[model samples]
Target: MSSAGPSPVRGGWLDPRKPFKDGVRPRKRQLGLALRDLCRLLHSDEPAETGRRPLKQAEAAKRLGCTADELSRYLNDTRIPSQDFLERLHKEAGTDAATSGQDVGITLEALLSLHTSALAERQGCEHCQEMSGRIDSLIQQVNAPCPQCAAHERRQEVRRRQLRRRQQRKLAIRLRSASKEQQTRLRLELAEVKVTVADLKAELAGKLATEAGLRERPAAAQPAGAQLPVPRRPGDRQLSARDVSAARQLVAQAEELDGSGREDLAFTLLQRSTAELLTPAETALVVVQLRCRERDRLADDLIHVYGRDQEKQDVMAVALELHEAGAPNDAGAVLRAALG
Candidate 1:
């Protein structure tokens, strides 16, 4: 005892109540969590007004006059509802001003503010840091793992490959078409050469016969190069370059208008483009499509807005008449199907 080594000091490592600085703080409370709590309270099996007879999601959506998907978003979305949505929801859910947490003395908005302040206080306190970290760790443990979208990416890759194949096939077709056109030109040139040779041979023979006849009788009054030229095909008329350029402009305008959601205006421009650029037959087909689409809209409007019950029948009669005429693949059939 007399020779005891100085005063025995016990100083190993001891865990303090406070945590170290620079640790991850607890996550802020999410609106989804708040909504989840409310939904649980509303749909609780025990001590709820509905009790054992719980309202199904579909039935609740039906009562609310919205889709079940929409109901899920309204009740479970992480984002706070807009003021307009809140008021509309208040009306739909029959949550009165008195019961919307003001009179009940418990409000989600107020609770959120209070919780934010409390969390801030804890985050600033060294003594509470350990508790915050523990709670965050536990919450993370309860979270579901993220799902991978690799299958979707694979599907997109397949679609892109299909598109590339289609484009390649189209390019091959165009090359084949050009080759066929070149072959056709070569064949036509060969035919022209043969015809020229035949003409030259005939001329030589005619000259020889003429010379022989002239030598014998001094009169052979007939030439063979006086044949009339054959006429070309009926629709072989070519368009001038100027006309094509004008038509292209109209088509560009039509596409622009279509992109802007002015389909009616787009139809007008397309009609103009066809009228200026296309043959009569091509124009007729375009007109058929436009008229058919318009006829459907007008027919429905006549019945609903104008109260003209016979308008559809009248339109059908006109279409049938056109079909009976040589226009059987006719605008009328298209119109009837569209309108009906």
Candidate 2:
């Protein structure tokens, strides 16, 4: 006789009817089988009042406020239903048994105990299994307080606090790095501003000396333009001490107007002063002093007017100095435009 390839198996892999020691049936599978049987008995036949046939899986899920697919998963041991679903199922089973005049042979407490034990077993934690047993005992004894419940809640709260602290530490580290980058940028800007201010102060002093020298000249030897009225055309450099003083006062008033939120008026006044009262270098100095938003425009105009070979060389030197001083990108851009 031919030898049999292998003995035919009595059951498939994971047979629910097998004993626990056989290792073929797990607690979850057992729970799923029990729930499936309960639902089958509950939805077996319609009541006399309804005069309808048994409900389909979809209709049963609709009554339980769940989808057919979710019900299928719960019955197949592929997914665990929530505690609320278990409680609701137990109540429905009791109602069905009462209507049909038959016993469900399963209590709400017993169902819940099985569900908890199944979940604890799935986690493979001895502590969880112990807690599940303690909780189950308390349920059977009605109104009995559980000491371990408070301790479990406290441990969860401590873990949440530790996680929050770690997130805060990460955020603080990022902020500190950002603050360092900002400080470095501010320091570079401050140095550039200082260099520009020094250059402006020198130009203003030279203008002052020229005005003083004009005053020392004899009346007959003085330039004819000096005798002209205020508000002269551009390039008329014969400004008297009074005219210089008046121009300075006008700039001061413009600064006040700007500070008072009248920027349009201040800008108009500054344009008039630069066009008629002050020389190119003096205008540049005032623009720097006021820290005008239109400083780039005014600087560009000055660069074009200072068109002689020597003046162009001076512009180049100033641009190199500002670049070396680590001026901000905007300031450096203006200087580069002047060079071109």
lDDT of each: 0.42, 0.56
What digit string (tens of lDDT, one per residue) describes model 2 on residues 172-213?
999999768655644553344345445555665677677677
Model 1 whole-model lDDT (C-alpha atoms): 0.42
TM-score of predicted model 1?
Answer: 0.24
- For model 2, the local distance difference test gives 0.56
Residue 17 accuracy (lDDT) in model 2: 54
RMSD of each: 23.8, 20.6
lDDT of 1 by residue, 144-246 (tens): 4544556777889999999999999999999999768755644553344345435544654575576565545423333454433222222222323432343
Candidate 2 stretches greater than 4 Å from native: 1-25, 44-53, 127-340
- How many residue pairs collide in each prediction? 0, 0
